[model samples]
Target chain A: MVAFIGQLGRNVIHAIAKLGDASIFAVSTLRLLFATPWQGKHFVMQLYAVGVGSLIIIIITGAFTGMVLALQGYHMLVKVGTEALLGSAVALSLIRELGPVLAALMFVGRAGSSITAEIGIMRVTEQMDALEMMAVNPQARVMLTRIVACAIALPLLVGIFDVVGLAAGYLVGVEMLGVNSGVYIGETIDKIALTDVYAGLTKSMYFGLLVGIICTYMGQRATPTTEGVAKATTQAVMICSVMVLVLDYIITSFYL
Target chain B: MIKTKGLTKTYGNVAALNDINLHIKGGEVTVILGGSGSGKTTLLRLLAGLESPTSGSIMFSGEDLAKISRKRLYELRLRVGMLFQYSALLNSLTVYENVAFPLREHTDLDKEVIHTMVTMKLEQVGLRGFEEMMPSQLSGGMAKRVAFARALAMDPQVVFFDEPTSGLDPISAGVISSLIHETTVKTRMTSVVVTHDVQAGLDIADHVILLWQGEIIAEGKSNTIKNSDDPRVQQFIEGRPNGPIPFSRSQTAYVDDLTHKPGCVRLE
Candidate 1:
C-alpha cells in the first residue's frame, strides 16, 4: 500500500512537470509572435491547411445539425402552441452553444490531428533537427505559424458554421415545415443579440488557442518513432476535444 | 576547429556517450567509426549542437556550445550544416526549393542569384536537371545528393554527415564516399562523418576516431587506424567474431547455456 501510494505520488509529480513544460513551450511560442522577420509565407500556408482544408466537413456537419434542431424544436414548440419560438430556439442554441463547440470538435478531429501527425513525423525523421541546423527556430518557424493560423482560422470557420446552420434552420422550419417565414426570420433576428455572436466567437478563439498549443506540444514531445507519432496524433485529437468541451462549459457558465 | 573536453550525454541511467576529449581539425575529413551501440551518432549530434551534453563542453572555435545563449546558438548554427542519415528532405518542397531553402531564409540574395547558386550546388553533387522533382519522387541516393546540395547551399564552414551511406548499395556508397572526399577537399570545410562502414571511412577520412561502449577507444590518422594494435580496434576493423570485443551481451556463460539441461543442476 505504501509503495502504491509512493508510485501515485511520483506519477502526479511527473504529470505536473509535463504540464509545466507545455506551459513554458506555449508562452515561448506566444512571445515569438512579435519577433522580427515574421514567417509570412509559412503562416499563409498553414492558413490554407488548417482553415480551407476544414471547410467542407464543417459545412456538412453544421447544415445537418441545424436542420435536425429545427425539426425537433418545431415539434416541441407546437405542443406548447408557441411554434413561432422554433426559430428563436434553433438560432439561440446554435449561435450560443452548438456552433462554436461543434466547430471546434470537428477542427480537433481534422486539422488538430493532422498538425500533430505532421510535426511528429518531422520529429521522427530528423527534419526538426535539420531546421535547427539551418538556424531556423522550429518553435517560431513551425509551431508559432501553425498556432496563429489556427487561431485566425477557427473564428472564421465558426462563423461559416453558424451562417450555414442558420440557413439550414430557415430552410427546414419555413420552406419544409410551413412555419411562417416572416415570423421565423423576425423572431430569430430579434432574439439573437450581438453579444451572443461575440460570446460564440470568443469561445472559438479560446478553443483554437487550446487546440493549437496542445497539438503542437504533444507533437514536439513525441518520441522519435512510428508508434510515437501515431500515439501523439490520437492523444492530440482526444485531449483537444475534451478541452474544447470543458472550456465550452466553463465559458458558457461565465457568460450566463 | 571543434573540440570537446570530458563531454558526456546520459539518458536516465544509461550513458549514450561518456566523458571524452576530442580535437577535430578544420579543413579536413574526420570519421567517427563504430559498430551498433557504440555512440558514434551521439558524438556527431553533440558536435552539431543538436543534443546538449550532460556534464562537459563542446567548443566550436573556443565558444562552448552548451553555454551559449539561444540567439547566439542560432547565429552559430548558421555557420554549420548537417546531412542527416536519411537525408530528411522536406517532403512538401521540390528539389529546387529544398536546395534554395537555406539561402532564402538566411540571405537577401535575389531570386535570379539564388537560382543560379542552387543550380551550381546541385551540379556539384551531380544532381543537375532534377530541380523540379519532389523528395518523394527521388531515389534514396538522389535524395541524399539533394540534401547534400542543400547542406552546402549556405557556404557553411563545417558540415556533419550521419551515416551517409547506410542504406545504399556498394556502388552508390562508393559514389557518396567519393563525393564526401571531393567536397571536403574542394570546399575546404571541416567535415565530421559518423558511419560503421570501414571501407567508406578509409576512403574519405584524414582523421579517424573509433568509439567503443561510449568512449573513444582509439584516435589517429586513417592509415594508422587500419594498422592499429588495440585489440578492440583490430577486432572491429578486421570484422572478427572472436576477439577481446564480446560478440553477445548476455551475462550467462555461453558454454554452460549450450550444454546444460533445462531445469537441471550443473554437475561439478
Candidate 2:
C-alpha cells in the first residue's frame, strides 16, 4: 500500500509538471499568433493539410453515423407509436452532439496525429534547432501555423459533417424507410434551434484549439529519439480525444 | 571569432564536455577531432549557442552566449550557420524551398534577388537542376551537399559543421571536403568542423583540437596533430582498438561479460 501510494504521488506530480509545461507553451503560441507577419503561405498549406486531407474520412463517418442514428431512433420510436419523431431525434442528436464530437475525434486520428508526428520528427532530426540557428522561431513558424489552421479547419469540417449527416438521415428516414419526406424534412428544420447549432459550432472551435495545443505542444517537446516521436504522436491523439469529450460535457452543461 | 573559457556541459549525471578552453581565429578552418563519444558535437553546439554550458562562458562574436537575452541571442544567431549531421532538410519541402528558407525568413530581399542567390548557392554545390526535387529523392551525398548550400545561403560570417564526412562513401566525403575547402578560401568565412574522420580533418583543417572523453587531450596545428606523440591522439589517429581508450573493458569487463559474471555483465 505504501509503495502504491508513493507511485501514485509520483504520477500525480509528473502530470502536474507536464500540465505546467503545456500551459507555458500554449501561452507562447498565443503570444506569437497575434504578432505581425502572419505566415500567410504556410497557413494556407496547413489549411490544405488539416482541412482537405481529412475530408473523405469526415464525410464517410458522418454519413454512417446519421444512418445508424436514424435506424436506432426508428426502432425505439416505432415501439412507442411515435415513429414520426425519428427525424427530430436524429437531427437533434447529430446537430447537438455527434457532429462536432465525432468530427473532432476523426480529426485527431487523421490530421492531428500526422501533424504531431511531423513536428516531433522535426525535433528529432534537429530541424527545430536549425530553425533557431537560422534566427527563425520554430514556435511562430511551425506551431502557430498548424494551431491556427486547425482552429479554423475544425469548425468548417464540423459544419460539413452536420450538413452531410442531416442529408444522410433524410436518405435513410424518407427514401429507404417509410417516413413521409415532407414531414421528415420539416421536422429536421423546425426541431433544431439557431442556439443548438451555435453551441455545437462553439464546441468544435474549442475542440480545435484543444487538439491544436496538445499536438503542437507534445510534438515540439518530443524527446529527441524515434521511440519518443512515436510515443508523442500516440499521446497527442489520445489526449486530444479525451480532452474533447471532457470539454464537450462541460460546454453542454452550460447550455443545459 | 569564437572563444571558450572553462566551458563544460553535463547532462544529468554524465559530462558530455568538461573544462575546455579554446580560441578559434576568424576566417580559419578549425577542426575538432574526436571519436564517437568524445563530446566533439557538444563543443560545436556550445560554440553555436544551441546549448548552454553548465559552468562557463562561450564568447561568440564578442558576446557571452549564456548571459545574453533570448532576443539578443537570436539577433546574434543571424550571422551564424550550421550544417547538421543528417542534412535536416524539411521532408515536405523541395530542395529549392529548403535552400531559400533562411533567406526568405530573415531577409526581405526581392523575390528575383532571392531566386538568383538560391540559384548561385545550388550551383556552387553542383545541384543546379535538382531544385524541384524533394530531399527524399536525393542520394545521401547529394542531400549533404544541398544542406551545405542551404547553410551557406545566408553567407554567414561564422559557420559550423557537425560530422560533415561521416556516414558517406570516400568519394562523396572527398567531394564535400573539397567543397568546404573551396568555399572557405573564396568566402574567407570562419569555419569550425567536428568530425571523427582523421584524414578529412587533417586535410582541410588549418588548426586541430583533439577531444577525448569529455576533455581536450591535444591542441595544435594540423601537422602537430599528425605528428603528435600523445598516446590518446596516436590511438585515435592510428585507429587502434586498445590503449588509453579501450573498447568496453574500461567501464565494464568485456571478458567478464562474455563469461556472464553477475556484477560485470553490462556493457556501455
Highest-TM-score candidate: 1
**What does the lDDT read for residue B25 in candidate 1?**
99
In angstroms, how far off is B96's CA in candidate 2? 1.1
Model 1 TM-score on chain A: 0.97
* Cα lDDT tens digits for candidate 2, A177-211: 88998888788788989999998998899999899
TM-score of each: 0.96, 0.95
Off by over 4 Å in 1: B253-268
lDDT of each: 0.93, 0.91
User: Model 1, clash count?
Assistant: 0
Kindly list the per-residue Cα lDDT of model 1 for residues A148-176, writing each as its tens digit.
99998999999999999999999999999
Residue-wise C-alpha lDDT for candidate 1, range B19-132, written one tens digit per residue? 989999999999999999999998998899888899999999999999998899989888898999999998889999999999999899999999999999999889999999
Q: Is the docking of candidate 2 incorrect, acceptable, medium or high quality?
A: high
